[model samples]
Target: MTDIRHRYRKLVYLTWFLTLDLIMFGAFVRLTDSGLGCPDWPGCYGKLTPLGAGAHIEQAYQAMPYGPVSWGKAWIEMIHRYVGAALGMLIIAIVWMAWRHRHALGHSARLALFTLLAVCVQGAFGAWTVTHKLMPLIVTTHLLGGMSVLALMTWLAARENPGPPVLLSTRRWRPWLIGAFLLLTIQIGLGGWVSTNYAALACMDFPQCHGQWIPDMDLHGGFSLFRALGELPSGEMISQAALTAIHWVHRNMAFLVFLILGSVAWKLRADPVLRRPATGVLLLLLAQLVTGLTTIFFQWPLLIAVLHNGGAAGLVLCCVTLLVRLSRKSTVPQGIQYDKHRHPGSRLAPAPISGTD
Candidate 1:
């Protein structure tokens, strides 16, 4: 039983790490404009590999040298798909091991099963992203689906290793944690919208858009979710104002996210058991701020953009870690009491076990 549990834990951690890589790579594919590199789903121009479709790729590249389809871009897109498929297999293994050792593992297999479902849905979205020609809605939804998978993997990893118990009173922070998570989710969605619409450089100025604190923006057109990519609901080409609105909203939302998540991290640092994850959140927040600004100043350099995407995923992991710690059933050792008065501002501190059990 010990061996089985150990194996299952290891597999989950592996999947968790791969999921993170997959998300960042997905960002790379999008940032590079290789999303349509192959112009097909699950294969390159009806061939299993780009090499197999050399003739088709060469023809497409020759026709439009600077277009989405090219030798390099095709390989990039296909490789992203390849990694995604590999991660799916890992998830299948996880689900199998989970049910196989359900009794010994002493936990429900529901999360594992749900994660499998999420990956499947994500795959479907990936196909639609290409077939639909990178429609902003489908593309953004695909991005969110990938993030969802990462979040689920983080939850599974947390379950495998319930860390040291935080004070039972930590439950009071659950609402704040939940709020931060939701805010981060919304911000990620907005960021996805900005990327899908190619609006990252729409404003072209920092701390102010178009050299003003506020710029002319078309909120309705920019946020009309049902329209096709770069087009308004009426089938008109999307305007610069609409694009500016997308970038502007995402930028403003970042400030709110920083404030809320930063506050939660500050509060969490006072708890010894939670300090590590809290520090992680704080550091990630700082890195995100830097990368986000650099992306703007550098005109969306590939590395900075990719790191910004990864930072969002890292924030997701840290937020989930905090949630898992705070939501668990804490078991205080016998004879120990939480001493709020002695610790003053600390969130949790254990009184010495009065006398050993």
Candidate 2:
């Protein structure tokens, strides 16, 4: 039994590490613009690695060497794919462990199985993302899917080795924190959509767009949410206004999200047990704000851009984990008590038999 417990703990840690790696690689894929480097699904130009199909790529490049299918892009795409495959393997391993020790690990087995299924769906979306030529909706979904996997893994990690549970006299704030977390996640998804669609700089100003606080936005064109990426309903190229609209909505939503999360942090800070995480959330939010501004002022420096995305992910994970901890029921026995009063005819209660007698 001890050995099983040890093994379970190791699996949980390993799963979390792999999930982190998956997120990093996903970031790299986005940052490098190698998302469509291969222009194919599951393989690079129909081969496992770019080098494996060098001759083919060379022929295509020879025809148009300056095109998007360059050697560097293909390598980046292939590397991302490899990392994703490795992560998939790790998820499978986690599922296997959970099934093997279902009883000991509580609901971990069920959760692991669900994670495994989610990753499979995410992988399919990833393939479609490339095959569809970096469709914005698909890409955004892919990003969210990866983050969801991370969230699940973090939740599992928290559950497996939760420290001493916190005892809160009031439960009202707990639901608010959960709501705040959900809102932040939705905001993050919108942000991902903006980034994936290359709409970050559509609104260059901090609190406004194109000299107007709310520049004339074409919601119909901008959010043509159902159209194929890069194309409008009429088969025309998507308008710049649409891209600007996407960026604008994301920018505006950030303010609201920040306000809500900031309030949550303030509320959480009142609890001693939650102070550290609350502070951490506050610090990360500040970092996110600064990096976001820097990206605008400095023309989106690669390092800052990556850091901003990573910070957002980190913030969500931290808040969610803290909320999980705060919600856990105390495990301490509540029936045990020491009584000082004694009954007149009994010894268990100390001097408390006057009324009874």
Candidate 3:
């Protein structure tokens, strides 16, 4: 059982790193405008490989010279899909291993299985992202789904920690930590919306938008949530006011999230188990803030913009790890309170001596 635990634990870590890499690559695909490169899903232009789609790629370019289709873009899109498919296979293996050792490993297996489900759902979102023509809502949801998968995998990995879980309630600030994590997640979603809607440069200036603090914005159109990539549901081009609304809201929310995370980091620094993750949280936040500023002031450079997405994903991973490390609950099944007694190494005192004599 111990050997099984160890092997599965290692697999979880590998899957985690791969998941993170996949996320960064997906961001690269999006930032580079390669999202529609293939103009198809799973396969590239009705073939298993992009090279096989040469004629179709050429036709696309010929039809719309500078549109989303290109040989390079097709390759990038296909590569992202391939990596994602590989990750999915890894997750399936995780489920199989978890099921094989379900009894011995307890909830660890359950966590792995749950991750499998999330990956499946995420794959669906990926398909939708392409078929729906990069609809802003779908694209943003796809980004959120990826971040959620990262969080799940991180938490599952923490479940296999060598030591006993260090529940958050032990400290007086557990609620604050949880709140900060949730706030950060919401902020990340807002950031995703801003990105998918192409609203990052809507304001072109920091502190003030369009040379005025709080330029007029259309929150209604900005947050419709059911619209396509660059237009309202009415098929009208999205107004500048709406894009400003998306960017403006995202920018202001960052301050609130920053304050929440900053306070949480300060609290975590005092605990040794928490200090490392705390430092991670702080550094990611700082880097994300810097990258965000550069994206705005410098007119959204590709490298910095993509790195901003990566930083956001990293922040999510750190939060999930911190929460799982601190919380007693595991994604593993155990009827809420883990019955450590059933597992080996459990030191539950023997049932009181029976007096049947």
Best lDDT among the predictions, by candidate number: 1
List the candidate 1 regions with Cα displacement exceeding 4 Å: 331-357
The C-alpha local distance difference test score for the whole of candidate 2 amounts to: 0.78
lDDT tens digits, residue span 174-281, model 1: 799899899999999999999999999998788999998889999999999998877999999999999999999999999999999999888888666688989999
Candidate 2, residues 1-357, lDDT tens digits: the string is 768878877877887887777676687778778787787878876787887888877777788766667788888888888888888898888888788888877788888988888889999999998887787788888988988888888888878766554434424578888888888888888888878767778877776688888788777777766667667767788777888888888887878878988888877776555678888888898898999889888888888888888888788678867877777776222222223333232123222223443
lDDT of each: 0.90, 0.78, 0.84
lDDT order, best first, reads: 1, 3, 2
Task: Provide backbone clash counts, one per model.
Answer: 0, 6, 2
| Candidate 2: 10-residue stretch with minimal lDDT | 345-354
Q: What is the lDDT of residue 108 in candidate 3?
A: 69
Candidate 3 residue 135 Cα shift, in angstroms, is 0.6
Task: Show model 3 residue runs off by greater than 4 Å.
Answer: 164-170, 329-357
Best-performing candidate as measured by TM-score: 1
Candidate 3 per-residue lDDT over residues 175-277, each given as its tens digit: 7888888888899889989989889999998888898887999999999988778898788999999999999999999989888888888777765557788
